[model samples]
Target: MKKNILLIGGSYGIGLELVKQLSEDYSVYVASRTSEGLEGTSATHITFDANTDSLDITALPNEIHGFAYCPGSINLKPFKMMSLDTFESDMQLNFFNMVKIVKDTLPLMTAGGAIVLFSTVAVGSGMPYHTSVAAAKGAVEGFAKALAAEYAPNIRVNVIAPSLVNTPLAKRLLSNDKKIEMMSQRHPLKRIGEVEDIANTAAFLLCEKSSWITGQVIGVDGGMSTLNLS
Candidate 1:
């Protein structure tokens, strides 16, 4: 039998790439706000807004082998300019909703299953202007580790912390050639990340090959989280 995987916010970016790859072998259920780019795929799409709506658990399969939460925010601002509401909103989207989804889906996951969540390089490596997002993703890192320990020997939970991926979510930061070059050069790999770069790693963690791995924060950030090439 094919494994059942649930992907939250799988309509675009890295999530979309995951849907394309995983659907070939596994049954995928995509939950996102729109299905614009998911046409011509066998994956099932469910309308969901992590910011407002709760997931309809009845729509998911009884036995889920993989779960990936792909919704996140990139709010870059100085600490002084960032407000309490900004922090709250980021936490809601990046951390709270993720926790809720896992809680709701935990019962559905089969033994040896895996859960993948997204984080950012900023959470580990300090970067200016990443106050809001880093703070939120920081919680995600902690949550992933704790949940992994809590569900050990059964479900594996891991987080991918990426740096400046060239997705719609980071379009603003990479809009101009100068901005792209600048961001690209900031990393030791001399290029920003692609959606597939992160998606592939996420897929691995969800697969049986990585069954031994859990409670780890894997960095998919073009060598940004480590190395001092400068």
Candidate 2:
């Protein structure tokens, strides 16, 4: 039997791309509210909503080799216009729920298992209209590092902090050619991140190739975090 990998959200975007890449080599299990875009993958789909429902652990394999949480939000609003509740909501979706899932399912992982989480480039680089999400994702980055230290040599934990990508989650930002061009120019790469860019790195982290890596936040940004070419 192949190794099992559980993903919290794999219906679309980077998660779906990772599912497509990993299912070929591992037994992929995806837990999401809808099986939309997963119609033909070899993955086992479980209906789950992180906002309200716990993972249907009964549907998972006895042992899980990897896990990734892919659900995220891109709330770009002025700080003052946004209330405290806005920040809390981002925390609930991005940090608290992930913590609950990992804690609940970690028992299924023994040694050499990898856990992947998502953050944002804004977490490290201060961007206007990103205060709420940046705070939330900052918590995620901090949590991943601590978790990795605690579980070192047993389970590997890492984070992927990405810049804007051309995913459904960012459709509004890159809706048109002019907007796409503007966003692209902000990065040294001069192009927005593709789902594959993030997913490929994610797949590597989950596999034995990255066996020695953990307790780190890998930037998958398009050189936006560290680049100054004027």
Say which candidate scores most in lDDT: 2
TM-score result, candidate 1: 0.98
Q: Which stretches of candidate 2 lie above 4 Å from their native place? A: none
Cα lDDT of candidate 1 equals: 0.93
lDDT of each: 0.93, 0.94
* TM-scores vs. true structure, each candidate: 0.98, 0.99
RMSD of each: 0.8, 0.7
What does candidate 2's lDDT look like per residue over 1-230, in tens digits? Answer: 89999999999999999999999899999999889799889999999999999887778889999999999999889988988988999999999999999998999996999999999999889999999899999999999999999998799999999999999999999999999999999999999999999999999999999999999899999899998798
- Looking at model 1, the pairs that clash are none
What C-alpha lDDT, on a 0 to 100 scale, does residue 132 get in candidate 1?
90
Q: What is the Å distance of residue 155 in model 1 from its true position?
A: 0.3
Query: What number of clashing residue pairs does each candidate have, in the order they appear?
Result: 0, 0
Clash pairs, candidate 2, are none
Compose the digit string of candidate 1's lDDT tens values, residues 1-230: 88999999888899999998898899999999999889998999999998888899999888999999999998888899988999999999999998898888889999999999999999899999999999899999999999999999999999999988999999999999999999889899999999999999999999999989999999998898889986
